[model samples]
Target: MISYLSASYIYPVTGPVLKNGVIGIDPDGLIRTVLSAEEAKNQNIELVTFYEGLLVPGFVNTHCHLELSHLKGKVEQHTGLTDFVQTVMKLRGADDSAIELAMLRADVEMLENGIVAVGDISNQAISSGIKRGSPIYYHTFLEVMGFNPATAKASINRALEFKQKFEGFPLSIVPHAPYSVSAELFEELRLVAEELPGPVSIHNQETPDENAFFERKEGGFLKLYEFLGLDIGFYEPSGKTSLQTVLPMMSDRQKTLLVHNTMSSNADVVFAKALHPLLYWCLCPNANLYIENKLPDVDMLRATGVKITLGTDSLASNTGLSIFAEMLCLQDNFDIPVEELIQWATANGAEFLGISDRYGSFETGKRPGINLLDFEEVNGRIVLGREMRRLY
Candidate 1:
């Protein structure tokens, strides 16, 4: 049996918006069809009215740190990424029960906000059980970072062991970032890519100091190392942007998701795209502001026509885990269109995570969860209101 849901606007995502649109879904939540209200009426389909909003596909969060859900409100805001990393390193460990409870709460929050899938970052096997039981589809990236060449082999071995611990889930081993990973570690990542190809997500160019550290081996990152007591005497400057150096090492066989990109320029996008055709750029606007108090050059990124996706980072660097909040932040700050933002929040992210077949857009045979984006009229244009509801 098919049931119909009608809304003020229906963004099928893969197609044009239908004014007073109706979507038909089967009992299993798979979309059966999307038609205009007049068409549905003419066809004698029974429709349920979802008053005053746009019905969209469920959000796909392309980047997150579920293991760090326990650190919400514990890490200070606007500390910059270097200091933020150090702070997380020091304080991420708490009582096991507290961490588990926090993970459960964060999971519930994302579900309430209509998140259907996540590309989560994991350093250890802590959240594997939670992810297995989650209603949300998860693709875990076992994050590995070793700035020292001597420890690269050990890091790869340990990351592989961690990957084995998540034997039943969708996952891949990936680098944490360009700055924290060494040349040898990147080679290890490449080997892993050759052996097990999947989507990869990594932190990128969130600060000027990251580029400085790569190009000249001098920046606040030096201070970060000093703070951590890391001996970087064997490291060499790449004399190029951090992305320019690391992106080339990635496997062209795998898709890569570059997160944050707060400092990525046109040249960086062009260079990275030329190296890997399957690259997707992910933006975490709220988390960027929470840590660095700056946003990516979104206009520059838009002009390049690179596929972009949205993420909520983690509760550690954000107040909550709503992609709606992430969207509002973009709309409030940038000149991007709501249509493009929705694409980033949905289809593009699902593609990056390799779940687009069933999660990105409202196509027949896909159970892309439906969400209602409640809106209000402002200056004669529809804009997102504070109220959001999950319809299916």
Candidate 2:
């Protein structure tokens, strides 16, 4: 049976917004068509009017670390990324039961916030069970890391074993970050991607210290290696930015998502686009503020005309797992339009995670999971009032 849902405005994402729109959906939730209220009335169609909010497609969280949900308030805010990483490593192994429960709660919270799909990062198989029974679609990135070149092969073997535990799920063995991954490990990931194709997400330029270490071989990362009791004897500075040095090691054949990018420059962005045409820039603004008290130069990112997506990172680095909250943070700081933010949170993310066919827009035959972005009209300007409500 066909049903009609009417709203004041419907953002199709793929097409123009329909004013006083009526969306026709089948019993199974597939969108049949979208028509204006007048068009529906002319056809003598019944409509179920939702008196408030703008109807939109469910959000896609393009980057997340589901396993780190237990570390919500464990680490203090405004700590640098190096200290944050050290604290996580020290405190993340407290209790298995607690970690599992936290992951479960985060999954439910995202579903409640109208997150229809996720591109989650995992260093281990701890989140496998949660994703197995999760209502939200997840594309797991089996993240592997090793700063030492000698251990790169061993690290890939261990990652392969971890990936085996997550069989029957959409998984990709990917590098963790430029600071944590050696050149050999990146080549290993590229070779694995040749066998099983998928997009790769890496923590990129989260701090200026990362680029500093790559440029002149002197920075906080030197102290970080000392703190971890690791030797950097074989390591050599490339005299370039961290992203510029490491991106060459990545596969141009596969699509890549550069997460964070808190310190990425215009030259780096241009180099990335030239290196990999299928590159995507992911912004986790809240997480950037939490760790470094700063945000990426979003204006520069926008100026590049690069496809941008939004991510919540993890509870450890953010207050919550809501894409709407992330967007609000950007809006408050950057003054971006709400419509453009919606596209970043929804359509661009879906395309990156390879779930666009069913999740991006409310096109015909797509079950995009209708969402209501509730807002209050304040002095002729629309202000988002509350958390997003899932309508389907």
Task: Give, for candidate 2, the lowest lDDT window spanning 10 residues.
Answer: 378-387
Name the TM-score of candidate 1. 0.97
**At residue 333, what lDDT does model 1 achieve?**
89
Cα TM-score per model:
0.97, 0.97
Expressed as tens digits, the lDDT of each residue in 1-392 for candidate 1 is 88888888888899988878888898889899888878888888764756688899999998989989999999999999889989998999899889889999999999999999999999999899899899999999999998888889999999998988899899999999998888899998888887779989889999999999999998899999888789999888989999999888888778889999999989999998788898999999999999999999999999999999999999889999999899999989886666788899999998888888999898888999999997776776667777788877
Tell me the spans in candidate 1 whose CA falls farther than 4 Å from its real position.
Answer: 377-381
- Candidate lDDT (C-alpha), each: 0.90, 0.90
Q: Tens-digit lDDT track for model 2 on 95-138?
A: 88999999999999999888999999999999999999998999
